[model samples]
Target: MRFFEATHKYPFDWETVSLASFRKYPNDKTPHVQHVEVLNQEIDPETGVLKTERLIMVKQNAPRLMMKLLGGSDSSYVLEYSEVDPRDKTLTMHSTNLTFSNLLTVGEKIVYKPDPEDTKNSTLFAQSAKLSADGVLSRFSSYIEETCLKRFHDNALVGKLGLEQVLHKILAEKRQERGGAGNMAA
Candidate 1:
């Protein structure tokens, strides 16, 4: 038997999801984006490079924005929020925006786990890519702009390992399966 401690409830901030979800909801009014202060940017001290997340930002207190994105037609309007606190922000949490449309359910519950080191903070965040509506691949690539992507050291092997390895494994399995199927047919 496995037991997990449930996290506390926090109103989901729709703004961060909204901008990242631009691909889902493209319109004339682009949610009035502004470059808010770089709250707590998650950086690798050893690499001297911004870690996996850097593009995400908290837009005040607009939890409804997520609803707008999830909801279609009538609910596409913008949701408002309060001022974003730089001190209360974190790159670990508010780093990548996800572009998922099916995540917005009216009565959906959001769970918040306060970082042990920073208790006063409650990020309207999902800890892992699998749990989040947007899968890991989409979320990871969305962080950097195309122009600057070249400068990043990790770009060279973007699809080399995961994709190629996956393909190689799939082909090998298919060959084995084909051989078995042919023998059975004979």
Candidate 2:
């Protein structure tokens, strides 16, 4: 008799997966989609179960004033941001719009000066960021480092218990159920 058992050794690496996915399919579309991202993963030694939560974000570019005049989205960029909540076992994704013209280079700073005379202009200007890809990337990376990491660990633990381990237990139970009720033939 051949015995088959599922283990928690399923392979996965987020950075590698992300890069590989992008390399395979590069794009400059209105809605940008990040790959199926692994927020966090953990394995239970006792149960031999793997737990993971995937996150994927899709964003549509917002039309800039010039783009709106020139036909929106043609000159805009959309970024999709996704993060997995390990603790809650949830996936979150959102799209943010950016103008191609407003992007700032790395190390460059754009300061917003509010005009006291025009309150409306002041409010708009105050809310606007430097609008640089580098700045956004920097902030995004920092957020992932600070907030997502801990949450991922917690999620992994929960998944190991609630999702992965439970799967194996159910499988094992099914196998046992199929083994045979009583007739022992020697």
Candidate 3:
């Protein structure tokens, strides 16, 4: 098994970043992400935390040879669980690939929170993922893990760019709404 961890600072507030994180899919930068379906959601009455489970469909980025060996389709499913703590201004998510569990397992965790070091409105993003190969792929586990890790690095940048695109779009909408409201009052 191999693992990687990284951190980034999104020049947006925690609320904005957290909101964009949930809505970060379906962007041109990360076209691999196809669909997301909320399986369950609920709010804690006492703690006021929101919990949700979602299934995400994404295109598999495996090598062609690996794909042929596995004889699997291009699409893969991932199961994710997340929590939002409004009081703490934190959002956390955990996800695991479900399609090729017999041969490989990929698990990830991500967290978003207010940047403690940055007084200038920003959010800290931290993420980690573990990759492992088993069964038929065990012989090439190290190489597979290394390849996946390299891909993860590229995808991480793409994911952040996707979120930024979403956030920009949302901010523009907000600006337009405010402009419309001002015009209405005039």
Candidate 4:
């Protein structure tokens, strides 16, 4: 198993960042993401936390070796689970690939919260991921591990770019609504 973690600072407040995260898909930067289907969404009556389950379809660009081993699949599904705590100003999300589990599995967790030092205008985003391969691929474990880790790292950057794009769009809309100058704060 290989693990990786990344931290990013967003100039937008936590609320804005959280809202944008939910709308991150369907953006140009992440064309690999094909669709998102919400399986369930509800608010906990006792804690007032919002919980959601979603299925996401992504077009796979598997390596030649992986494609050969997995019969050349073109897409895969991921299951996403998330919880939002308004009172705590936190959003926690976890996702796992539903396909190719035996050959390769990628699981990721993300936490979004208000930056204590600059809660009004800044948010902190942290993510950690685990990559593992087993089963018939054990003989090629090293190769598989390396490929999966590199892919995950590259995709992490793309994910961040996609979120930033969504945040910018949201800010632009808010500015238009206020009839303010075209310049954005960040």
Per-residue lDDT of candidate 4, residues 74-159 (tens digit): 89999999999999999999999998886778899999999999999999999999888865456787788888798789888999
lDDT of model 2, residue 26: 21
Ranking under lDDT, best-scoring first? 4, 3, 2, 1
Q: How does candidate 3 score on lDDT?
A: 0.89
TM-score of each: 0.21, 0.24, 0.94, 0.93
CA lDDT of every candidate: 0.31, 0.33, 0.89, 0.91
> Where does candidate 4 stray beyond 4 Å?
180-186
Residue-level lDDT of model 3, residues 50-105, one tens digit each, is: 99999999985789988888798999999999999999988999999899887778
Cα deviation at 177, candidate 2, in Å, is: 2.5
Scored against the true structure, residue 14 in model 2 reaches a CA lDDT of 28
Among all windows of 10 consecutive residues in model 4, the one with the lowest summed lDDT is: 177-186
Q: Which candidate number has the best TM-score?
A: 3
Task: Report how far residue 6 has shifted in candidate 1, in Å.
Answer: 42
Clashes of each: 1, 4, 0, 0
Pairs clashing in candidate 1?
Answer: 61-82
**Candidate 1, which segments miss by more than 4 Å at Cα?**
1-158
- The CA-based lDDT of model 4 is what? 0.91
